[model samples]
Target: MDRTILKSQLERYRTPYEEESAFIDSFIDLTSDPLAYKRERLEGHFTASAWIVNRRRTHTLLTLHRKLGRWLQLGGHADGDENLIEVAMKEAKEESGLTSLDLVDSTIFDLDKHIIPERPHVPEHYHFDVRYILEADINEPLHISDESISLAWITFDSVVDMIGYNPSILRMLEKTSKSEILL
Candidate 1:
């Protein structure tokens, strides 16, 4: 897991969103350390999340984050892992209890920067989340982990309505809508 690899991947991502482009530039300009994922690094750590869709592509899995108490995608701190894709998949599997997930696309699907409020010992900081899309079976039995209060597979049309309107989720929905696997 090298910072150079992450930098190259971000550079290769093509998106119409100007904000994400800016985020990429900022991420590259900020630091060259692979340990930038650590919270102690402080400038803004790399986080990874998965926009997980079922094989039919009609539904997506979301978790009611226990700590955050919000309906959000499955993911967590990169925790020193420079391979964001692997981090995303690991979080997805850990949170959703889905053992069989296939990468829908190897390319980065979305980018977001959000503030995480201070909680107890953890200080408030920014999370530079790199998102990826994964495909799994909707019919598979899901086991909810302690990390989430609940987990549900929401229909594509009902996502924003169910989870609350989130720009990143909307962006991912738009991207997946145009993907051949989803079609």
Candidate 2:
């Protein structure tokens, strides 16, 4: 994602503890695996998420996630906040550092509720994610962030060609793109 814009935007904040906590809590809860712990129902501690789709050049802006290692859209937990559309905007700004953006006229692509698998080291965590899909236009350039190792503007159709080391994010991208959930 981007950096210069985020750095400028975050310069006024003294500490990011509160924001980080909310985001991390939501993320851990969503990606944790509940079934492995014999829990049939997720606590639903973190059910909210928002992702932005950027139409860039002949393709859409996608992130090559650092941890998840896949070419995917920009998204993160809601931090328990219901203003998911704003959350999508915030994540798009912070992660990609792009300032020229607006939520698509129609939230053109939503997806099925899905479970985020827990990592091997943290199997008890699980997230029942209610994902919202949004789109944006990149009027300027893109900035990258540590959260992702790389970034690209990829076509909606070329996603399947880029294999993901971790299939979870890949599945998410596929499902979100294939479904007609946006309204």
Candidate 3:
């Protein structure tokens, strides 16, 4: 998979949180591996997500993940695709049925490494997730894909109450709140 674009983006990303310095560094290093973006790598693989917000930036979309049974941002495995921005856009459209999505920024918005529990055939592995901020018209109708049980636009203030203190979610929210575009 081509990684130059991903490497360039990662190199340009600067985390706001001091504690995330290591995570960013580690993610950059992961890009060095030729197979790092492949799902078959096992150790971990790249996944892209959309932190989809409404035109007003007041509400962010969340999907009730079918497999994980949790309300989380819309995303999926790279499946050998190297361009994560494209992956994120495709996933957002596929998962949410919103075709008018617009990328708020092309750079990485957040990076997270989380473990995927072992399934019957798929062994436990880590997902090195890359998140991007995207905007869409909230008035557009939403069609739930098979990947999600339901999809909803959750207000920023109510996300924590719904997800219960997930650090990644909080960090994304904090970033969004502080973003100049929202000012």
Best by TM-score: 3
| Runs of candidate 1 exceeding 4 Å displacement | 180-182
- Give Cα distance to truth, residue 118, candidate 2, Å: 3.2
Regions of candidate 3 where Cα sits further than 4 Å from its true position: none
Clash-forming residue pairs, model 1: none
- The lDDT-based order of candidates, best leading, equals 3, 1, 2
TM-scores, all candidates, are 0.93, 0.55, 0.95
Q: Write the per-residue lDDT of candidate 1 for residues 2-92, one digit (tens) a residue.
A: 6777788777877887766767776775447655878786657889999999887898899999998988999999888888899999999
* Superior candidate under TM-score, 2 versus 3: 3
TM-score of 2: 0.55
Rank order by TM-score, top first? 3, 1, 2
The global C-alpha lDDT for each of the candidates, from Candidate 1 onward, is 0.84, 0.50, 0.89
Q: Per-residue error at 109 for model 3, in Å?
A: 0.9
Kindly list the per-residue Cα lDDT of model 3 for residues 45-67, writing each as its tens digit.
89999999998879999999999
